[model samples]
Target: MRVVADWARQESWGVRLEWGLAGARALGPGSACVVVVDVLSFTTSVSVAVERGTRVLPYPWRDGGAAEFAAQRGAVVAVGRRSVSEQQPWSLSPAGLRRAPAAERLVLPSPNGSAISAAVDGVPVIAGCLRNATAVAGWIVRQGWGTVRQPVSVVAAGEHWPGEDLLRPAIEDWVGAGAIVAALARSGAGPLSPEAAAAMAGSVGITDIPTLIADCASGRELADSGFAGDVAVATELDVSAVVPVLTNGAFDDAR
Candidate 1:
């Protein structure tokens, strides 16, 4: 095993924030809990599905293999947002998931959020989004995770460039992560790292987050692709009380 500098790990703080897959890897090892923020879709969809009592298995890739993985688990696999149809409605879109019939389990795949969630190991993984940010924070505190002895890492699962490996550093996910960090701070769950504090501060001035999110690049892309309702569903701040925590290889309501 290669030794990583403690500085890179943000080891001094109770709560820390980082971006994308590399971020999750850098901070995940020492964290008591890692909150995965993918506000535009993956985490948001998990929130919606878990709220409706569905266990969501986050598949790292949205490829043909996802169906096989779901089939092995006897779970319904979610298709792409634009692929939802009359016979098969479940997709990465939160609004679509909300409208889909309740199932015992679902396999939701994504290149960003689900990839991050699937990569992190050992520590408890909690899905955090705009709709359940406060709830997720409180649950982390209740689990005694956000303390100096047992730190928490908040990871923003940013989007990838089309057909590219480059991360987009999505504003919506940054804000979503900030919302959770802010809530955690309010609950006295942190001696937050500078990065975490910055995330919280970033969320402090967003007085019109709904409009800001809707007008953002990812949001506009989804809107142009006819998934505008997904954006609307994702921007509903703190409306959900469900905290979806990954347990036994799947996300289920922990609230």
Candidate 2:
């Protein structure tokens, strides 16, 4: 094997906050657990689907043969947020999923969150969003990661820049992650890392979440694209009791 090494490895053994796949890999190996925050709208959709009694299989993307992936598992693949119809019912809209009849499994695809999720295996992963932040954190604690005080990595699945490979950090996801970090510390799961602490502080800095999220870059982008309802649904706080944990590569209600 040819010797090939590059970036310096910065690993975390305590609660840490990281952005995107690089962070996920840095903190994932042998870590206690991971909380993937993808507010618009992978985890949000997961929260919705799991709450409605359906398992979500997060495919890497809608293209790249996602249909084949779903078909192989006998699951229904979700289409674009606005692509919903009587024949094609599932979509990326959290609110719409709430109204749709629950299915056995759904192949939810996304460029950010699902990719992050698919990258991490052998570690307990929970889909975190504004709607279910508290519940997910509380669930992590109840799993003994809190009492024993193991490291919990909060990974933000950020948005990609338009027409570029670079990931753009979305304010909504930062705030959503902040909510989870704060909840974890509040529940005495463990003390937050400096980065995580700052994120939690940021989450607390915003009081008017609905208004703030609506005005954010990602939010406005979604709104401009006619997904305002999705932004609204994702901004709801602590209204969910469902914790979508990945089991055997599929997210299901672990509550």
For model 2, state the Cα shift of residue 173 in Å: 0.6
Instruction: Report the C-alpha lDDT of model 2 over 1-255, residue by residue, as the tens digit.
Output: 222233322233356788997778777765688899999899999998987789999878735898889899988888887788887788888878887878898998888999899889789889999999889988888877743247789998899998888989989889999999989988886656778888999999987988998999998998898879899999888999999999998998887
The predictions' CA RMSDs to the true structure, in order, are 1.1, 2.5
| lDDT of the structure predicted as candidate 1 | 0.92
Per-model TM-score, in order, reads: 0.97, 0.93
Which pairs in model 2 have colliding backbones? none
The most accurate candidate by lDDT is 1
lDDT of 1 by residue, 1-255 (tens): 456678899998999999998999999997898999999899999999998999999888745699899999999888877688877789888888888898799999999999999989899999999999889999899888898899999999999999898999999999999999999999998899999999899998799999999999999999998889999999998999998999998999886
| Candidate 2 lDDT score at position 92 | 82
